[model samples]
Target chain A: MRITNFLFDKVGKWSKQFSNLPDRYIKRAMEQVYWRNPKGIQYKPNAVVKRKKYHFSVHRPWTGEFRQENSPGRLHPKVFVEPIKEWSFFRGDRVEILVGKDKGKQGIIKQIFQERNWVIVEGLNCKLKQIGDDKEFSGVYIQEEKPLLVTTDVKLVDPSDLTATTIEWRFTEDGDKVRVSTRTGRIIPIPASVEETIDYKTKATYLEQPKDTKADAVTEITFEPKLATFEMDIMEKMGIKDDRVPPKSFWY
Target chain B: MANLRVMCKLLKNLNISNVKAHSIPSDRRYKNWGAQEVKSGRSWKKEELRLKSNSDLHKYVLLKERNMLLTMEEEAKAQIQLFPSPERIDKVEDSMENLESVIRERNVAYHKLETGRTGERPYKMSKNAFGLRYRHEMSEYTMPKHMNKDWYEEFRSYKHDRYTEQFLLKYREKSYVSKRRQQIRDFNHVIHLLNRFPDMDMQALKEQYPNVDIEKAKASRKYGGHFAPK
Candidate 1:
């Protein structure tokens, strides 16, 4: 099986992109394996009894809340998400609400849940949730933004007219893919905020940590083609020599 | 006892500090202790590793980083303290894997150009004693298969017998049952999706489940929603 199929099959690219965590880390943190075949000569060499499917919610797969929701022995109804050819909505894109009380109002996308074709618009489509109500205490109510279906509940806003417009994917003369407004026939530029993540606003402006390799050192091209294998080259560079070659080996 | 105490005092007064090569220094432990979070950039990409020389890639930087992270994690567990940035281990591992893959690619290209064969370990689909087919990676030995009596004794292939045939029949049936169940589950799920989203893109659905027969699924009773005829 392909590695991506097992690792990030359920996690949509947009959902995990904002967290700025490696795919390996997310897979390691979220997997709940109950049993696995031990290393030995066995009938089944690599049999792994693990949770094959997960219920994607507003909480990300690596979060504690998601674990609580998908705790052991708790089964959730299967969610059927309509498959879309391409994901057009992204964080910081101006979108108009097409459903609910917030219909016709425009807001920027704060988060995306691509697995369910869901997005939460900033300050729009909110519901009041009561928290920590007690016998003697009045509960505090807070406004929580609810996820809206991107297919039926929102439309991208055309930058030229600032109105909701249908969009189509098109290519420019330079071969760069762009989103074009179908109504105005204008190119709706993707905002710079698309690159914003929890760690930094953009990769170029990311503050290098104490352990980060310097940028120039990483980009330096030090490789020179040679008529030798990696081992041969390394051994030659290290001045290691092995002249004895009388042993014959067989493979079965 | 007094003389031993005086010796201990003398030893203490000498200010002798025991240092070991493997142990993390006490000063570094103090720095790592009680830290809530540790920040780091992403791991090395394949493109970056490709630009590196063979000697530079062979250095033990990635291995040392992994060993240090593992040591720190073990220490944190032993002390019942939080391990800051456990993801750093994954980052280091990811870099190591990328570095290995890049080296493998270069090696494969060189082998293909020189010897017209991949330099990787050879494997073949062979049956075990149980008659189950598995990929058997070939290993080097001093003796050939004809002369190796121990190898034959250990890895003897399945012999035809009544009990063996019955076991194979049951195993195949079990595999077929699981496969059939999976196909049925996908069929029902596709029908549900079609029922829910009547105007859903058919091409996308077909692309998602290439095995499912969409025309047959549309003809099922569960394909349409419960509503009065318009």
Candidate 2:
């Protein structure tokens, strides 16, 4: 298939291209001129925005992956600056919800937040107390506001997988640094690039379940934290095509 | 620590500012010929960049682009084969383009700041005869076509078909939460890289960021380098 190079040019040309439309629509589209691809720069990933760095307001739009947990109509996310616990690092490390209804989910850690903590694990453990009439009162009490852990809980992944494709650094006596499947002893090489940058995860590390990878089916997400930094930046700062994001309290 | 410093100084002494000599034993020409500049490196990081003023930033960006262009020119001058990926130069060009645009925007903002135009008056938006809608801003859009304010209002209510709808569906994609999340993820990832391989070479960071001062990153408490427990 031939690739389209529309992104090579800014969409502002649309302002002059489509000069006739409804006022409201035109207004919406006008706002879009500043909103959509306002600038071209890889500013998101590998970023630090605490003080000096420029920080733009993030827009919320549903990425299809978020539906695995909550529907758009009923969203309860959490936001925060740090994981509640220090020792609780990702992939088993400490984790906390930074936004939404279930703002704080502790204990389950060692996972990465793709977009929000809600997407990682069912973490918001606090129960919301709804006061009701005397007829419904079994006594004054409280309940868990939401879950504390979901399938999306952050976790740590192994780096050995990345080095598998890397060129051999040391060779004393044994074979090359490439790994063999622990069970079947099959070498899993991407076979695309001989360069060291090629990241080939051995079966022992990344077990791509057919269900999850199969496009036709609704794949179940297993608790696997051994993932790689595939997409450099999914955020706007990164000059990419994806234009999707989850609402507030997803993750910090 | 002192050895790398000495080597760094020695490399500098050679008067080859753009190239660095490798200390690695793997290079066959460690004694005969030396490590010429196969690849120089990327430029400064955000923290260093933040320290620079607006003019300095512009000059720095221009210097980088010019240096990169000169480097590419030198490659041809040496009669060596052109880089397999000339897009590397394109990437450099793209960065220069971005820097120039950002500077231009900042200059305009500065001009606005100078003029004492504090609060921006809300401008009305409408479509013209060509089904195109634009914000009527007198600040810059005061030309011949833009002056046709009536033409814009007249066709401001036209319908668009499916094909037209696709190209017009442009909108900002990221939000505060998502961008923050991704940044946190990337930061944690750097930390994770340090944690997992405390013994990993600090020089590797130089490969990832040849221009960035790795010494600063090393000094950071967050840097996951191996050290004797206190």
Residue B53 lDDT, candidate 1, scale 0-100: 86
* Tens digits of lDDT, candidate 2, B133-221: 65544332333545567645643444676644553443123355555565455444445555554545565433433334545545667
| DockQ for the candidates, in order | 0.26, 0.02
Across residues A8-54, which tens digit of lDDT does each residue of candidate 1 receive? Answer: 34788988888878889888888889999998677778899887777
**Candidate 1, chain A: TM-score?**
0.91
lDDT of 1 by residue, B1-230 (tens): 22121111000111112323367677765675679778766777788789988988876667777877899899899999989878888888888888899999999999999999998999999877667889999999999999999998888867878877887899899988977777787788889889889889898888777778999998998888788989
Mind listing the fnat for each candidate? 0.53, 0.00
Best by lDDT: 1
Off by over 4 Å in 1: A1-9, B1-29, B109-116, B160-162
Whole-model Cα lDDT per candidate?
0.81, 0.33
Error of 1 at B192 (Å): 1.5
Model 2 agreement with the true structure over A1-252: per-residue lDDT tens digits: 001111111122212121212223222222212123332222232243211111111111112232223332343332321211112122332334545554443443322322222323334445556555387565555664342322232222223342211122232356654433343334433232211111112222222221121211111121122111112212222456655683432100
All candidates' TM-scores?
A: 0.88, 0.23
Query: What shift in Å separates residue B205 of candidate 2 from its native position after superposition?
Result: 34
